[model samples]
Target: MAISLHWLIALLIFAGWGLGFYMHDLPLSPAKLRYYSWHKWMGVTTFILAFLRAGWLATHPAPRLPRVIPPWQTRTARITHFVLYLLMFLIPLSGWLMSSAKGVPTVYFGVLPLPDLIGKDKALGDFLVQVHKWLAFGLAALVGLHIAAAMKHHFMDRDGLMGRMVPFLKSPRL
Candidate 1:
């Protein structure tokens, strides 16, 4: 069976987001550590999957959008996609930097290790940590808007645009 890689990526993205969101303040109990463990694993998985997705995208570009989509909507989608890709690369990078600076090691799926992108630098690490936090917030906003737009196209416009991503959905014609 052909796996829905896009949906898989989306689910991982949301899962990672949830884990990342509360990690800062959560106590490091066994249960809480489990959350961080999942977060770390999910981050690594997302990084690898994103690399695969990018390779796939390079080889097979996305399909042309429906002509009925307004130019503004097209532009927004393009920009949002760009941001998502940026976050895909930057989030893990920043995390790696932050962890490395704090003398922490990153293990991928508890098997392989990832090299730190940069040597430990307290100032730079702190800056990257802040960047990572804000970028996540931006990602949350963009994701929300993207979902809303997809729903609008599906419901209000009765367009099949949303069905492109959500292949299971049956869009009604207006």
Candidate 2:
């Protein structure tokens, strides 16, 4: 369940990020509006998935790192994971708040309408737009670091950490 949710959320985040960059420069039109709506829906879904993943984590604590892993590296990994989770929640939330401040209602998949969290305020909306953009870039950077660390463990360190998340792959030689 954890692995499935991890990949699903990862896929959604990448797709949403790609769409966000693509639509940013486009002139205001129906297509842009449609893209924004889809992006907003994706953000909402990502937020919910992040919440569910956190609940799962709370119940099922992650396995401990191998004793051979230096204590500092373990600490860094823990911190990185925590920040990643934090960004996962914050990115979408800022986007939602920004939309609310912009006086735009977020309709979930065109079915359910979510209420604005704050009253319309153009200045606040503009601020949140920057916040959301920066948070997303931070997330992208962290994800790159996370992947790099995983690959370093798998290929360079010959650790089985990657295989644990990817069951089909054989554990690397220790």
lDDT of 1 by residue, 20-76 (tens): 877778877878766766787887777777788878887878888989989998998
Write down the lDDT of every candidate, Cα atoms only.
0.79, 0.95
**What is the Å distance of residue 141 in model 2 from its true position?**
1.1
RMSD of each: 2.2, 1.2
lDDT of 2 by residue, 79-150 (tens): 999999999999999999999999999999999999999999999999999999999999999999999999
Pairs that collide in candidate 2 are none
Report model 1's TM-score to 2 decimal places. 0.88
Off by over 4 Å in 1: 1-3, 29-34
Kindly report which residue pairs in candidate 1 clash with one another. Answer: none
Best model number under TM-score: 2
